[model samples]
Target: MQLIKPFRKLVVSVLLIGSSIFSVSSAIAQESSVESRILVNVDVIYPVNYLKEEFKKISSNPTQADVVQIGGQLNFSTIPDIQAIRFSRSFIYDPFANDYYNNRNVGGSDFNYSDQASTSNPFLSATFTERKGNPPLTLSFNSSGSNPPALAYNGTSCKDNDGCVLMHYGYSEEITSRNALTPSLFKTILKLRDNNGNLVSMINAMATPIVTSSSGGVTQYLIAYHEQSDPANNGVLMGVWTEIPVASGISSNSMLLQKQLKDIVQNQSQSPRLSYSNSSNSKITISNTRYFLSSTQIPLDQLSRTSLPPTDSRFMPLPNADGTISPGETTKPVIIAQTQSAKKAMTWVINNKVDVNGETYVQARYDSKTNPYSGDTSVDQTLSLLCIRKSPELTSNPIPEIAKGTTYTNSWSGGEVFAIPEVVGNSLLSEQNADNKCQEEGQKRYSLSGFRMAEFHDGIQPSGFGFYAKSTDPNLSISNVRYWVKINDQNANPWSK
Candidate 1:
């Protein structure tokens, strides 16, 4: 079996007791860019003693992967314009190369902790029995330091004051050798009645190192996240993550390369980059955009991308410790940004340029009320990816015009408690408790939802300038409204008002 869970399947969770201040050594969102979502690997750790010893070992001659020399990695997005949260000290690590996961001599020699060694994190016990009896479940992730590692946050899609909700940790589906070592705590992560593995938030249990043959006073493993998440599942093993992979020497100062990295991600080329903050008092001003859906009987009512867009488009990117973006192998699709007054709480993605029925339409899905961890799903508005469309606005502007017709609408009684936005014609989606059961109920359905992450647009196939919504009400009923309109469903035409 692989030393770590496949990045795309599932993860671990536990409440962390740590602190952090921003510094960059690391990694952002845009079209083709996957938002960095944090995942936990509780099984990895790095003893401080190991670092000190390694530092000493390399004092005479440094190996290529020397950590004291090279720094940790960052979690950057694909788009140049969008920025990822930077952690100067956050670098990626490897299990095979560094052997941080299972602490021991580089040659695989098992060792013991110092006679006066401190116990590892409590959750360490939940996954292992290496020491027999140590405090289990103690989540002191870089606790109370001005520079504790940051778990990941997209900086958008949050309420006035609430940063995006973090759900990085998850439990293993079945106990493996790591957790099996301590079967007693393993059950806690299983399907217990009240507390299951699915609930623990190991947002910061980034590293958890065990005793290895290498003599060291402290060992703190580096943890990195791939672009994978299973909200409906449980926690990642106790561990650590780094933005840059340590297949070779990793600097402790690579955090100094923020601007150069940001410059490489030219996402701001098309639309203006929107800024969002965590302060509830901090209000965002969305530029002019329109989205309307009016009956031919009411031609005056229209929907335009110019009028409104998805409310919020900010969330942490997929935790790609390797720093891959733009359709990363493990990265999830990007989240669409909004340019309107009301913020969208649910998430939206372009499923198809047009529907399976082969009409000139776009489709997507969103299920915010239930499990948001089911890849490509969002719970809050902080998404920073581009939406999918058929053509760039330059060539395909002015999509085929549909004569105004009677408005068709329907309602679902069991609507989402947290009104999510599913782009028009989208279907492959999951609700909180409604796994694989996404549905719509209307005669001539046109429930266009999801975000528009692209910085620019060309009225064309897949690319649309039309109606989508984020119901202001909790029930997701249409009564609370945000309707949009555009010039005949394409880029703004001379005819559009």
Candidate 2:
């Protein structure tokens, strides 16, 4: 029993040692495999022989010469695990080829056909030729289902000169299932790079909702057209488009594809008009007569021309030649003529005893009649004249002080003026009574004041008044007193009794 127990223990020890050795060997093998894969991916990104072949193919005359020059650089460190790289190239037709060559004028001048031909270059191809390089050049690999499996190449041209580089044409591929590398799944990558093999930028991809992860790498080719300096040497024009093709597994392919797509979208041709819409509104008519130019009231001098109608003969009458009225002779029809000035017209009406509304009437014709004209017996006529001439001046005149202690004021220096006084006496007063009761009201210890009337002259005269007052009593205090006037010719009867 003892011997058996020792033998069993020995067997167990050997088995444990052997298992440990096997485990170490397996781990080493796995590490070596990973390293081999990394090296392969690195070589694919910098394949010297493949690049040379690509150059040769691009430069070939009739067979495969659409590519012009491949520019930019390839970077593999962006995605270290996947071996990502980015590249770009330009494409143009070979002008030196016998069948496809033609010297044509583009933008009023003839440029070598082999020179970089781009849309903005203002150069037109004499003959449209088939493209040689694969459009939307793609790289494929296997990777996690989430990672995209394809990458694409993008093309561009210089804006200023053919020799310069500019990105123009680009496209993106739809990411599909892990195993599928369909044409639609390819995309053109656009990237910026310096002379050295260093990436400057990666343009965004064009299509959206890329099903695959942004993992694929990118490759760039500079399409260059070689033109002879001498004009007579048959001018052999050639171009080359080169790119480093990665042969690593799916991860490397995914990295390159992502980079290429980004380049194509961000650096390629952009739409000139991003968006547009109609902008318009309903029409409006404005005129000086209909609307004022500014809130600031204008003086008479600044006013535009105003139109006045001719006076009616019935509204105005002139003195007869004879001293007495002729028997059976109807009163001479009053004749009124249009006047340029409002002051002149008012004077004529007052002095001539115009039969306004079939009754003789006159208001204060001048400054002398401010006390009320004596000859005009017709109250209606007098009131009519006062309404036309006196009230306007009263409302328009600037406020004047009534007395040292009183808040109300009056202006007697004016032409014709009138006002409505707020009598403190309880009884209401007629227009005639109010005029004569001024003294009575004054004697009663009640304040008698005149309020200025709005201005009334012709030819665009302003018609408004400004009044201000201050009092301790809230009810008696006048916060604001403004006056405005408009002609009421329909109700006016200057000669009515």
Model 2 segments more than 4 A misplaced: 1-317, 320-322, 340-480, 483-497
| Candidate 2 C-alpha lDDT tens digits along 124-167 | 11122223332322111122212112111121211111121112
lDDT tens readout by residue for model 1, 1-497: 00221122111222212322122212211112112212222222222222223335434221112111111111212122222221111321211122121122222111111111011221222121112232121121232422221232232221212111111112221111100001111111211011112221112111111110111111111122222112221222121211110111222322222232232112322111111111111111211111211111110101110111112121123221222111122112111122222212223333223222242333223223311222222211222222321223312232233211112111111111122243321111112111111211110122322222221112222332222221222223322222111122332211211
Error of 1 at 285 (Å): 44
Give per-model CA RMSD.
24.3, 43.9
Q: How far out, in Å, is residue 312 in model 1?
A: 16
Off by over 4 Å in 1: 1-40, 43-55, 58-360, 363-398, 402-497
Tell how far residue 267 is off in model 1, in angstroms. Answer: 58
lDDT for each of the candidates?
0.20, 0.18
Candidate 2 positional error at 278, Å: 77
* Leading candidate by TM-score: 1
